[model samples]
Target: MTTYPGMPAAPKKSVLPTIAIACLVIGVLVTGFFVYRIVVTVPGTPQPIEAGMVHLEKEGLTIYASVPVLTPACEAQDASGNDVPLKGPTGSETITINDDTWYVVARSTQPVPAGDYSISCTDDETSATYAAGPKSSVVAFVLSILGAVFSFLIFVGLGATLLTVGAVRKRRGNRPTNTFPGPPGAPSNYSQQPPTTPQQSNTFPAPPPYNPGPNPDRPQDR
Candidate 1:
């Protein structure tokens, strides 16, 4: 049988497309998990205010107050008595439900490295309650959710691009290739021809001159 001793055949398809699909799947799962972590615990348990002073920690510590407490009337300070920077809530829920009706009065969107903290607010009838919790802040929650989504999007985008590249590579890999040249004397375009063999001679040779009993009739000429 004929064979190509010098030709290299096309290789198998690429695995990049498969990798892209897996990446996309993983991205979605991760994004879902992160968002869930931030959302499932809305209005997270917080440190309650005691005697107008509440010790809080973390940057996103959200301050929650009773409906009657004016957000602007509240202030916060650290253990060193230095005023803790506070700003109006941005991109956070105005109200959350925990043990009672609480409104998000103020918060700091900037990463305020608020360590231990104290709160001072006028409780005219001492009927208002206050607390601080990072999870309670809607702004922080939304930002976290957005971060997760953006990460997912980036992964998906890369996956999609890789998948496209893989598809093209696979198509190229699957294409037929010619590794060896055609037979000798073949046209440049190439064409097959049946093999041939030498033909046998047909005519037979004449018998040698009558070799009858040479000495029978003629005397043995010395």
Candidate 2:
């Protein structure tokens, strides 16, 4: 097919919509996974303390420990057995499972270096110092959840923008190109037909009879 020199080529199909859809699907899947982790995977059975000492490690700024009952005080120590002052609880909550009660604890604002650590708690009722068992960090879990939420929002926003742009382009591509003549009263460049002249009627005068009278007077006797 011949293309005019200045005429625009047909618009190509947009890839933006496909990319947007892919992003949306991926974002939803990732968001769902993070939500599942926050809701179902984060909480775990509390480890019991033994012998006034528990060995553990820190993944973030703080470490957490849970106990069966309320304790008067708690503290942590480095692997070298140096006493580290326990930061105030970032979070503490009571949870019950199978008729047993547990206190979930989180550490303070200062981040602890990631490594082995020991936890010790003092019982208020018995004045006994006890060691806690290996446990997970609540602060790390909470941070993970927040990070996931932020990522999900970004993915959704990007996907929505791409989809909107693609849809607008597609609509423009589908619109019909106008090639018809202008309205009846509009002026045109073509030459106009000349006006017709009116036809005239034919008329003629009658001829006179031949005259031989002068010569007829002498020739009439013969």
Candidate 3:
């Protein structure tokens, strides 16, 4: 659209809202990731893994050992004595309690209903340190959760601020405006000129008329 000079014009449409939405979506996904981590191990009480029946509060529990369980070397069973499915973890996550360390080994791929289960590992013999669930102190766990929440808020705030600014600019651009005329600009290549005066003639008539009259009177008398 045509616009007048000094007039506010609507800004060009942008993909900022799209970008903001993307940021929000990614933020939620990331936040969910933290939430999942917190949920998986946070609530479970740490119990020593052994050959006999152990009380497990949640399913998909991580199998921990001093060494990695490379295979389905470890397995579990439900309350009814049926063998439960277990899969080794894709990555390593560990926790240390009282200077003793236990690494994750395997977990249930699907949710197992909450109850007691018998945990058995074929190759693991280090019975003293074998354990499952989170071992981090209460303080560290709280900090990690706070960090996730802080990151989520930052992303959401950024998106919301961008959306608000864009909307305000668009509204202002669409609004009608008044522009007061300003003082005229100086002439281009102009300069001040000096004043001009009329010129006078330099020549004047001689006194010859008087001499010619005297000579005429003298000739008449002769």
Candidate 4:
């Protein structure tokens, strides 16, 4: 095989594409998991709240409950059948039962006013009413969606980076290397040089002196 003297070797194959593909798959899985958590209720034995009226002995009562995707509308009522709005504190807490996770929905700082009262929650989507207790909130659902979108975008960016690197490597691998040209009139494997010629001498040999015979007019002159 003919080889160029100063040619660089072809680039090695790149693993970036493989790594990018893995990242994409992982990102998809993570996004799907977060989306599922947002929509589905935590799995466990259901805890049913009492059907009758509940009395709040203290001003600040923390409510905990499990709910689906949408946040529920909740209220408290006094014995006089007057509706009271419940206040929710910021942040939430998680509860685990048999390895299943649940979220605290609301907490109130104001006093309930010692009296016969009832708490109820209505689903925002279905408008179904239930005894007020604990349920998932809008915050959890929004957070889950945000997390999923962020994770997916990050992974996609990584994959794009890897793909770009792989393409660059492939292009380099296929590129032609610089080559040195062979000498003129030389064999394929040999280097050629200019031919050398001998120099001529400047001096020449002297000719012998000229000799003449006796002329006819001077015959007999001996």
Candidate 5:
């Protein structure tokens, strides 16, 4: 149960892979949302009217009883059933669809004939304008899908990374490791001393007393 001082702790299984997986999921979701928003329309929303009838009053003036639909996702057509590009003086005019609403558009290139002009209205649910036009709703839709995909990918990546790191740590933990000698073991390569034999001291016999010359001198004196 003891942990080594320098050993790294096992990584928890709750990180990296989770983040990556989240990102991937978020990305896909955002993409799907974008697709959906581009398709459906809500009633009573400000939609464009095409081929709208215009009542001409003067040489240079044409008054459209109902303004042409110029918003993205809706298509505008002329009275002749031709696609009408929301342009000219009335192109950007804001006209309500109510019975009392009226829009004034003017043109200088051609003299207005004093007559009644009729235009038609049609809704194109698959118009490219919704996908690429400045007012297209696809941008928001796409972002939602992307966000979801990214989140999912992030989760996956974080989870995988955490799992891998934890597994490696566990493997190392179970392996036998070289241990440094501490209090329980002797130091490596310790040497022991061998016993030796005791040495004996030799004693020579005492030399005879040195009394020859001294005895002769004493005798002469006596």
Candidate 6:
């Protein structure tokens, strides 16, 4: 029987292949999740938002505001406290204020011009901050559940792989019953019995010196 010396062969692996596989799996999962969100959770279509119009009244430099104390309200006023005719269109539009755009309510009037003009809307100004509907909430819950499942699968896979490798090593008679050297109470530097065969020294062999010219005693005029 022949025996091989040196470390055991490690499982074959390639950096590019592993990375590509991981990226592909991640891309597929992410694309599926996003598609699900867009189709099911997100609102299918936006309905028209109604707006109640209030004619502006001139009073001093600022308009004395009077809005209903009930449903969503939007205040429209100008610098000179004059009523500015607005289309009051519903559904979504951008209004500029001081060169900065502010996305007001779809049901509200457009923003006022520069100067002392300012319009306030009940709708949130931040586009990212949306009033999530029930469908969106349910979608979030589903995503959370999926995330948990994926995490569990990864952890379980890793643990099972490690356990299987350990079992195989044990069957091959290489498992360590004790990884530490000697008894627990023994000092770390405690010497042990030397190997039966003496170890070969690692010192380098001596080299012969170089003679540049002929020996002085041998030369001398030939």
Most TM-score-accurate candidate = 1
Tens-digit lDDT string for candidate 5 (1-222): 567864545545544455546655655565566455434311112222232444433322222324333332223333455543443452453333344343333222344334444433333643321110112222354565565466545654555666677567667667755454444476543554699888887988989887654454576755
All candidates' lDDT scores?
A: 0.67, 0.59, 0.66, 0.61, 0.42, 0.40
Model 6: how far residue 79 lies from native, Å: 34
Distance (Å) between predicted and true CA of 130, model 2?
6.5
lDDT of 1 by residue, 126-188 (tens): 576777766354556777778788879988888999999987887777676655566777644
lDDT of 6 by residue, 115-185 (tens): 43344446443323111001113346457557646654664455455556655654666433333355679
Query: What is the TM-score (0 to 1) of candidate 3?
Result: 0.43
Error of 2 at 15 (Å): 9.8
Candidate 4 per-residue lDDT, tens place, 3-37, comes to 56656554566789899999999988999999897
lDDT of 1: 0.67
lDDT of 6: 0.40
- Model 5 residue 33 lDDT score: 60
**Among these predicted structures, which one has the highest lDDT?**
1
Listed in order, each prediction's TM-score against the native is: 0.50, 0.47, 0.43, 0.43, 0.29, 0.21
Candidate 2: TM-score?
0.47
Residue pairs whose backbone atoms clash in candidate 6 = none
| Model 2: per-residue Cα lDDT over 81-184, one tens digit each | 87765545444654444665455544534545656566656555653323333334556668769867976998888899999998888888887664434457
Q: Order the candidates by lDDT, highest first.
A: 1, 3, 4, 2, 5, 6
**TM-score of model 1 (CA atoms):** 0.50
